[model samples]
Target chain A: MRNITLSKAVNEALAEEMRLDSTVILMGEDVAEAGTPFKVTSGLVEEFGTTRVIDTPISEPGFTGLAVGAAMTGLRPVVDIMFGDFLFLIMDQLCNQAAKTHYMSGGKLTVPMVVRTNMGATRRSAAQHSQSLHALVAHIPGIKVAMPSSAYEAKGLMKTAIRDNNPVIIFEDKLMYQDKAPVPEQEYLIPFGAAHILREGSDITLVATSSMVQVAQAAALHLAEQGVSAEVIDPRTIAPLDEETILTSVKKTSRAIVIDEGHQSYGVTAEIAARIAEKAFYHLDAPVQRLGAMDVPIPFSPALEDLTVPTPDDVVARALMAMRGELFHAL
Target chain B: MAKPAQKNSDAYLHMYRQMVKIRVFEDSANELYLTAKMPGLTHMYSGQEAVAVGICEALETRDKITSTHRGHGHCVAKGANFKQMFCELLGKDEGYCHGKGGSMHIADQANGNLGANAIVGGSAGIATGAALTAKTLGTGDVAVCFFGDGALGQGLLYECMNMAALWDLPVIYACENNLYGEYTHVSEMAAGALMDRASAFGIEGHEVDGQDVLAVNELSQQLVARARNGEGPFFMLLNTYRYHGHHVGDINRAYYRSKEEETFWKETRDPITNFGDWLVTEKLASFDELQALHAEIKTEAKAAVNYALSAAYPAVEDVTEHVFAETV
Candidate 1:
């Protein structure tokens, strides 16, 4: 095992995949020379050459559509969107073309492509750059959505997404790119829809995604000191959601709280909470609580921005409410 | 410009057959829609047959082409079966997309047809990307992007053309300037000349008489050869017109265009009639032979429509299929 940052894990995955398959190519703004603004693809051009590591003009719709067409033809293209918020610029390619090609062609064509983008708000990049829009893509069918929590999960999920035959979007938490964790030296792959159980407890289940996994884990530790045993579940992929694991965990705990960075209404947290309420209605001891970012746009002020998204304290408070059964009447 | 030696009779006959096939197929589709035999909307490829047939004649089976919403001509020109196309229009199970994509999304990937895009300039990037794939893989294949004049204002098309020229990718941007961008005149929507769009990117651009199938074919040969030889992308503006309305439901076009203007082109500039006249005048085939070919194609189109009408709709359970190549 080797300790590496999440960004390094992503770079390793791209390098290993390009080494394994000649068809794997990378394209994005400054992805080849400058390795993106985040520097995730910094040294890829040296190892893979410019042919495989392509730096495209700063046109999101143009390059995104080109990547879709490239995937349809022969190459397996991994397009870096630079920022997850820029997805709105390329929605026509992502949502309409890439996501619907396989189905629209009646299974005659497959778009084996990966769109690597970053999300989260801690860097104070303001509203446009700090939004987490995974739910917008998760709502669309045919496209798979993956969000990695740690360096290990990032490496595994990135490899799996690169090899998948359909269009897959992997949203890496920009705030967690520098976070280090132990990853296996050899190759590994984490399949889609498999939720990882970080910790097991009996009081309640904390269903988290992306960077919220760390937040939920910290909250679980805080709850443990107060005699509350909270189980933490990290759903790696949001589209092919691990409903089985979530349902089973909710049944075991009889209470659940969903934590996400996206907005609270009509978002990933709301979807998960609604599913738990519908599927595990009789198994619940209290209402399923959802803790997510506020409905307001992410502000530039540090204080306002920090308060917009849920913190470890917020998860702990929600878990405590679920455990005390006070959440039942509030819902 | 010097005229080349007389072409082979077989080549002219093939071009005539292709144009006739597109015309007959589109006429049958219009009839089907009017008679309520077919469901959904359709954009006819009438009057623009020579452009699709002529340009496609220059392409090899392995060379790719991306098409627009009015794509039946491109699909037929790219060698798609008329029976399957009818099945698609009728929303039958044997269709290309199993009744899912309908008219606007017919694709034959195996035949190097990269599907028809409903968006105006949507397929330009796809064609450019396919050229990039060919260049990277050393496939020696060229891609043609077939869009209408309406797409001239799209920024994505310019972006794609800029990249293709910068990288010297093997792509052909075939713009069929049919005088209008849907309801509005092309003059109102576009600024300066259409060919200037390509010249601004340092790519060579040309204009062709869209009604003259032989003219389009002759120019396409040079452009396709240039791309295949790694000479980079080329743009061609095919000056053409659509005899029918933009779509099947857009029959009353008097609000947008004058009847006299439409009749002037229909009588003098009809691609099939002009090509038929040329075939006779050049002694390539007698008028009787051309008539016999048209009759045969009409029968074939009728048979395809009958087959599609008899074909079943996709099963209700199969509606969920093809959502992914491999289900997760």
Candidate 2:
């Protein structure tokens, strides 16, 4: 295993996939010359030339739909959205067309397309730039949504997403891009709908997604000092959710806290919490608590933004409350 | 010496039959709706038969098409099974989409019938995307988008036009003007002419007399041939009119358009009658043969309605089925 940052792992995966498949082409606003907004695709254009590493005009809906069309015919396209917030501009193509083509066409066509986008509350990118709306896409039927919290999972999940037959949206956390992890040097792919147990404990099961995984891990570490062990579970994908892993963990611990960067209402956390209540409600010793952003436009101010999004402290406090059989209503 | 032209008589006869079939089917559908025999809204395609028939005649069997709400003509002209279409409208288990998609959303992708969208300008972007797929995959296929004059004002249409022009995609933007955009007049709603809009995007455009099936057929042949030869896209604005209300729900006598204008356009600009007159006056076809074709289509449409009515309704459990493909 080789230690690498999450951004480098994605770069390596793209380079390897492009090398293996001639039909694999990358397109986005600044993917070719600018080396991606986060530099996850640095040196890719230099390696693969302009034909493979395409820099499209700032036409999200046009290029995104084009990529879906291309994928439906033969080629596999990796499209990068500079920010997750901009997905609203092209939701028609992504949610309606890309997600429905295979089924609408009565299984006559398949879109083997991968959309790589960054989501987080860090960087103070303001209301339009710092929002995690993967839940909106997860509500759609056909599309698959994956959020990798580590460099190792990034490479594996990206490879799996690219090779998958359906359209997969890979939401990479902006803060986790710089975080390092031991990624295998050899070729590998992390299967979708699988949950990773970041830490094991008997006290409480802290379920998190995207960047919240890191926050949950930090909270678990801090709680370890207080002699309170917390099991952190990172569900890599939200659509094909690994309910078995979450239910099992919650059943064992009898307490749970779901940390998400999106709004609490009808969000991924709410869905997960509802699922837990439906299946493992009897096992829960306490009410299901979710630590997520307040229901509002993500604030631009650093202080207000910090207050809105769930931080490690927020996650820990919530987990501790759940462990103590305390119900804290903060919706 | 030039090679002898293949016997296109059979092909032309088939096209004529299909166009008549669409007109007959639509007329019957309107009658059914008026008699309260059919449930839900029905968008009639009575007077715009030639536009769909002319363009679809130029396409190969595998070439795709994206259609608008008034899409029964396009579906019939492109050789969609009449029974299946009737079944879809009836919301039956044996429907094309298994009762999930009704008249507005009827699709059969196996035969390259991409879909007919409910939104006025929704299919343009999708058609452009489908054409991009064809070009990218080297499929040697083209996609045709059929919309009304109302769609000409939509941003998605312009976006698609710009993208298709920039990439030189294999797409045909077939706009059936029909003189009216819902209740509003096209002249009042549209900012500029459609040909000017296409020119602004650096795409070729043509304005055709939609009543003349031969003119549209000949022009579309050239455009489809160009697309097949890998030379960009074509936009054709068919100047025509609908013989019925915009939708079945709005069949009031007095609203926006005058009775005189509707009568003048319908009586003078009827595409089927014009085509039939040209066939007979020019001695290209006989009156008896045309009557026989019309008769055959009426019988076929009746059979389709019977088939649809006799078909079973889908089980309640099947409502949740096919939300997504099971495999991927």
Candidate 3:
């Protein structure tokens, strides 16, 4: 095993796929010349040249729609939207066209395209630049959403997404890019609906995703001082969620805490909480605790911003309260 | 320009048959819609036969075309099955899209007909992308996108043109300037000239008389050949018009267009009658031969109607069948 950053893992995955298939092409705002906005595609332009590693104008709907057309015509194009917020401008291509092409074509054609966009906040980039809207995409049926928390999962899940016949949306968080993880040197791919158990304990289960995976680990370490063992689980993919892993952990630990970076109102955290209450209700000793961003616009001030998003301390406090059933009266 | 062969006489007659086939198809579809035989909205391609036939006749079998709402002529010229096309209009199971896609969405990927879009300028990007695929895969195929003058103002069209010109993609943008963009006149809605839009993207463009099939056909042959040879994209604006309302059930006339302009276009600028007259004067076909061809088309259209009426609807259980293939 070799330790690598998330950026190098993505670079290796793309390089391997490009080597395997000659028809694969990459296009985005700065994918060719300036590398990527996040530097994920640092040296691809020099390796593949300008033809295959294409640099496109700042036309999201245009380039994204073009990727859909190219995919339908026997070429698999991987498109990178500069930021997740800009995806709103091209919703017509994504929601109306790409998502419905195969269904409307009546199985005559397949749209084998991949869209990569960066998610979450870094250094107080403020409201428009920083947002986690994975829930909005998960609402649609045709696309698969991959939210990997480590370098190993990032490379493995991307290979699976590229080989899949359907459209896939891979959301990467900015904060998770520099995290270190040991990935295998040989070729490997992670299945779409599988989850990874990071830590094993018997007291409580902490189910998190993306950047919150680190936060969950920190919370588990903090809870160890009080003699409360915590188990951490990461549902690597959000759309076809691995509910079995989360449910099994909750059943053994008899409690759960969902740490999400998105808004608290009707988001992925709510979905996971609802599923656990429906299936593993009898095994739980208390109600599920959901720790997520506050229901407000992200502030520019660092002091105000720290209070909105969930921290490791917040996760630990919520987990200890739910473990003891102290926050609720009836429970 | 390439020489029109001694077989040009027979080819001219065959071209007339294609034009009349499209004219009769649109005419019969209009009549069927009046009798409530077809569902959804219908945009008949009544007067614009020369643009579709002239352009498609110049394309090789490996070439592809993208169409718009007024797409019956392009569909016929590209050799889409008439029986399946009518079945699609009738919403039958044997339709091009298994009855899921109606008139505006009929597509046969096997025939290289990419599909007709209902959105004003949606096909531009798709056609451009297909051209990009052809270049990347080293396939010697060219793509043509047919849109009205109304689509010239869309931002996506400009984006597609700039990208195609920058990459030297094998594409031909055939703009059918039918004078009217829905109810509004093109002079009012469109800005600048058509050739200026092409030049802005560094592409060679031409303005042709769309009523003359020979002129449009000659221009298309040169342009399509240039594209196939990897000389980059071409833009041609066909000055044409529509004989009917924007769509079926649109009878209000006094709102945007005057009756005099409509009558002038109907009498003088009719592409089908112009081509038929040329075929007769040039000794390509006699009057009886042309009349017999029209009667045969009517009979063929009648059989198509019968076939569409008898075809079955798609089963309800298969709604979620083709969302994704079983394997990559």
How large an RMSD does model 2 have?
A: 2.9
Question: Where in model 1 is the C-alpha error above 4 Å?
Answer: A327-331, B1-6
Candidate 2, B139-238: lDDT as tens digits: 8898898999988777778877887887788999998998788888898989866689889988999998887777788888889989988887888989
lDDT of 3 by residue, B1-328 (tens): 1234344687788778889999888988888899888887889888888899999988876677888989889989988767998988887778887777688877778877877888888888788888999899878888999999889888888888888998899999999999888888899988777789999989999898887787888888888888989997999999888888899877786798889988998898787777777778778888889999999999999899888978887888777777665454
Candidate 3 chain A weakest lDDT stretch, 10 residues: A322-331
iRMSD value for model 1? 1.2
Evaluation by DockQ, superior candidate among 1 and 3: 1
> How many clashes in each structure?
0, 0, 0
User: What is model 3's DockQ versus the real complex?
Assistant: 0.55
- Candidate 2 chain B lowest-lDDT run of ten: B1-10
Per-residue accuracy of model 2 over A1-331 as CA lDDT, tens digit each: 6799999999999999999987888988889879987898989999998767877778887778767766765678999999999899878888877887665544556778999997888588898888888988999998999998889989999998888888999999887888999988889988999999989999899999988888899999999988888999999998789999999999999989999988988898899999999999999898988778899888888878888878888877777777676656553
- Specify the CAPRI tier of model 2: acceptable
Q: Each model's C-alpha lDDT?
A: 0.92, 0.83, 0.85
**Candidate 3 Cα misplacement greater than 4 A, ranges:** A200-205, A223-231, A243-257, A273-292, A324-331, B1-7
Select the stronger candidate by DockQ from 2 and 3.
3
Interface RMSD, all candidates in order, equals 1.2, 2.7, 1.4
Evaluated on chain B only, candidate 3 has a TM-score of: 0.96
